[model samples]
Target: SHIIDVIECKTFEDLLATTQPLEEYLANAGCLRPLRRLEDKNLLVDDILMFQVLHRVRGPFERFRDGLRTLGVLDKIKGHPESFRPLLCWSPTMLTADLVDSLFTINLSPVGSNRRHAEEVGTQKLGTILAFATGANTVPPIGFFPQPSIEFLHQEQDTATPSKLPIANTCINCLKLPLHTSYRAFQENMDFALGNTHGFGMVKFLIVSHY
Candidate 1:
């Protein structure tokens, strides 16, 4: 009933009031017993619910919660509740650019003399495009991208198809662009892959590949 009440809450204030008892319990018991109770009922607390909880009980809980969800461990945790600790107990670092950068492998042409220059330009452009979509300072949250440890490959020009567009593998977050071709074409294809909101009419397109 309390979980239902939390889900039905229309506003942050209402949710806060409803979760007050849980907060008190957390303070006294030193664990999130009320939240763990969801596991007994086979109910999963999602991002919105967790966000509301985080507002009152701040820490690295979101990171823990999201990591579990990303790893498909929510169901496992529900089955093995005793094996897991309360989200409040975790204090992992929030996602950062360095952390995200470590996940990606940028591959450029080995023989091309302008490989380094192309890499720099292409990487800068990608960052700029992401910033434009997310409105974040250069590096946005890892959630904005489709996945981690994405491979960036340079697309070479083929004589059969000289005007091929950039390809974005959203499933794996791999981006293949003509980084070895003309700068103008490369920029155009890059914009087409991640930007360029020409035919959407009224709806503003953020990340093109995402849509």
Candidate 2:
């Protein structure tokens, strides 16, 4: 059975803190190539649940340093000369603000895909977080993994009984409701909304900014 650590956070620190335990727990559990869900109850099959931190949780990144330090998660990857694999999860508001282009000032306009949006957000806050951490002469350059969506290994709502799966789109999982997902087309509505790529970007962008 796979386990999911679903953690909701209001700050970057909280987000980083939550991930540490998850990293340790999963690493100890021998979980390699963590899996994630795309949309609906669909997962990458055998992957760890990644309730990733998003843009909205920004402020005083120092809070995350300790958790990261204790876990050595960042340290372990410092010399690899790479960035965290990109993910399309949350989009920040600053980049998508109505006046961002002029009225609002933020690098990288927030548009299309949740993962890229979050990457931009992380970039701003990471500077502060890394500076506060330790043994810091310079920070590793982090880049976003450009893709359509974030990797989400959605856990089965119920592990006991099996349920019928829709042969195609247009069918909702009767067994799961509130948390269950439905598809508008062949693609699973990951964000569970009534829109396409544009819609997804708008919705996720709002979420990353505010929440």
Candidate 3:
């Protein structure tokens, strides 16, 4: 039967509603073979179950699982399951002052006006924005921001038009912002762009401003 059909079945519904062990039920129904295969590859079954139960099976999760199954890494993972634990059970690291300082590389020269703007708003304000956007202020998942470092750029040339919004180059995990009229406007724009879901997809390296 299809996985969706199995999930929507009366037996599955009864299993969910009852105090019966889900694992046992699945095992009895021969539904746990795939899960066992994943476990054999050292994948965290609990985490997968949690993700399916809470967020449903997302595209990324499906792709990841499919990749694992297709790659034939069962023997490799079986040999060193412990090595994968750190990755599976990763603890979220909160954004700190030192981390903020180390996270971004300012592309502008020290004497440049753009550099001064970056220095003024990039350090503290950018950190705040990143923290908020990535949920670094609270407990965030490991997938929140995969890349630790970001390239900060202030391309004044790109801002020839005053109406142009900031540009985020996701390919290189670079945040290139156009010159704004004021600090407040810059902050507001950053907040709006980073915080909004439709602004940029999956902010892997914090605020990814785009035109």
lDDT per residue for candidate 1 within 1-211, as digits (tens), equals: 5457667766656655666767754354343433433233223234335545655456576776778887679778888776676652575778999999998987776644687677676566656454333333255444646442333354346544333354444345454444445777766665664555322231133243334
List residue ranges in candidate 3 displaced over 4 A: 1-159, 162-164, 199-211
Top lDDT: which candidate number? 1
Residue-wise C-alpha lDDT for candidate 2, range 86-189, written one tens digit per residue: 33235455555455657855556557778667768545544432222221224435522221121222346775432222111112211121233445432333
Ranking by lDDT: 1, 3, 2
lDDT digits (tens) for residues 81-151 of candidate 3: 89877766777789999999898885655665876766676455555454533435333555444453444
Which residue segments of model 1 deviate by more than 4 Å? 1-159, 197-211
In model 2, which regions exceed 4 Å deviation? 1-59, 81-83, 87-211
* CA lDDT, every model vs. true structure: 0.52, 0.37, 0.51
Q: Of models 1 and 2, which has the larger TM-score?
A: 1
TM-score of 2: 0.14
The most accurate candidate by TM-score is: 3
Supply the TM-score for candidate 1: 0.23
* Candidate structures ordered by TM-score, highest first: 3, 1, 2
